[model samples]
Target: MKPVRFWVGLVLVALGVLGILDATGALETGGLLSGWWPASLVGLGIVAMLSQRRMSIGPAAVTVIGLILLAGTLDLAEGGLWWPALLAVAGFAVLAGLRREHSTRTPLVMFGGATTREQSRHLRHTDVSAIFGGSTLDLRQARIDEGATVDAFALFGGVKVLVPRGWRISLGGLPFMGGLEDKTDSTGDLPADAPVLAVNGTAIFGGVEVTNTPEK
Candidate 1:
């Protein structure tokens, strides 16, 4: 199993066990779930860092934010530290973006909605983010001659990626208090040289969906 899926399952099973124990009085959680939930985000961030081919800014940011939130929940830190953390994250993202191809367009939506359609003949990597809003990327008209990667992040919002039907899709990412749904059509019987698209990133308090068809 993929590391992301394994970690997600482990977290869910742990939560289920804890709930059962707490309900039966075999163990007293004492609001542990309510207070320590941010720890899952931390774990997810670490897992993402270790599992992917390269370290991603999204995971690093998630780790830092999770730590801050966890500290605040435990009364070990102030609740107003979000701005500083977010600024740090933005700086990191900018630095990372500088290293990427100039043709790559990083789509970011905040408190609104946006859509991007890629018709590139040599598509490579794509990054899409949504914060308190929605973002969509349509790549059905694009051609992936070689491998490609997609990094998607959604926080309190949603991200939808529509890709062409015959490419091989490898979905990897963590969903914290959120969901990741893959609806891409299978690339059955495709030649070994067929293009491969690897989707990786994080969804916190939101969702990410990849499909070959638009939602009806």
Candidate 2:
């Protein structure tokens, strides 16, 4: 789940608790059809969040439906529907952005300007002449395509690129007690300039690699 989304749910729980207290006449409610309604909605939000923990509710369609239904049930009160709707959208957004598998490949986990992910059981970076890094490859087609637009592409599994030597290669992101970029020659044809760069990250387990890049 998203950090913001989780916190929002927590806020709902707090609101629900207060609502219940008010409904029981122990506290004063602002006259919004008893505190029970708010409490009930909070309960629903909790359920939604919990369900998201194991398996995502998917694609935001269901969440939007629920939010709309909830707003309607609340008699479409003034400025009340926005929060619930936003929560639903945020939850689904996080769900859609996470990786479900531990391994995947496309010959090259290209990460750069318009790096196209060509899907195949054995991915081949025909665009370039060399590979960098010393990681494995050929994973099942994954959900989250780990391509970054401006910065480096992050990796969690591992990467092995076959590129010519002498080319500049930069990568970051390391594993616990593990090395950052272990180099190897998969094709023996390396650029004389050692064109290999491994990008590292602060995270102990995630990493990134760039290879077979033609110098502009």
Candidate 3:
């Protein structure tokens, strides 16, 4: 997390505490979320910080800070500390996320992780010359070490595989369409022989394509 993000996170947490106290009639309302809201925000901030990469620091803080600012703004938009501070912190975070997202073309070769609640990523295999999402997908672009491949185990985001015109492939699994696989878009050439690879995950809004079963 950026130094600003970390400090913003800290301040948010403090605000949450104060909000809780205020909701319980211990402190002034000062315009903020109900007491419980801060607790939820604190948890989110912590998670974003932990999972955030160098490029994801700003966006990572968005969910938490955005929400907190929204709360404070709603309460104090007309006046008080929240008016300017809310605009500054929340706006800063948004710009940070946008800038990060806009500049993210470095190509992530390996990405994976997890948490209790939610997570996600947007990977395009078409842009990838090599793929190793746990298994191994290699070629000249891959076999010859021509391109880069991302190897991961438990990724939460959507995967977009971009294959050559006639690249053949196979993965072990019963030919059944279901779950996050989004069968309507699953396509891959599995030669007569291959191993079964089971894939189970949700498609928030994207296509899931499989070349085919791994050759036996």
lDDT of each: 0.78, 0.37, 0.34
lDDT of 2 by residue, 189-208 (tens): 54454423333221113343
Better of 1 and 2 by TM-score: 1
Clashes of 3: 26
Better of 2 and 3 by TM-score: 3
Q: List runs of model 2 lying over 4 Å from the truth.
A: 5-9, 28-59, 75-216
Residue clash pairs of candidate 1 = none
Q: Residue by residue across 48-101, what tens digits does model 1's lDDT show?
A: 667764445556666777877787778765656667767867776776677466
Expressed as tens digits, the lDDT of each residue in 1-216 for candidate 3 is: 143235445666777788689889987766444434544544544443343333233223334455565556456445565555557566645655565443322222223311111111322221111112222222212221122222111122333332333333332211112112322223556443322223221121122344323224
- In candidate 1, stretches whose alpha carbon ends up further than 4 angstroms from where it belongs are 55-61, 79-87, 101-103, 108-112, 119-121, 129-133, 140-143, 152-158, 163-216
- lDDT score of model 2? 0.37
RMSDs, each prediction? Answer: 4.8, 15.1, 13.4
Ten-residue stretch with the least lDDT total in model 2:
124-133
Question: Residue 115 CA error for candidate 2 (Å)?
Answer: 27
**TM-scores of the models, in the order given:** 0.64, 0.25, 0.30
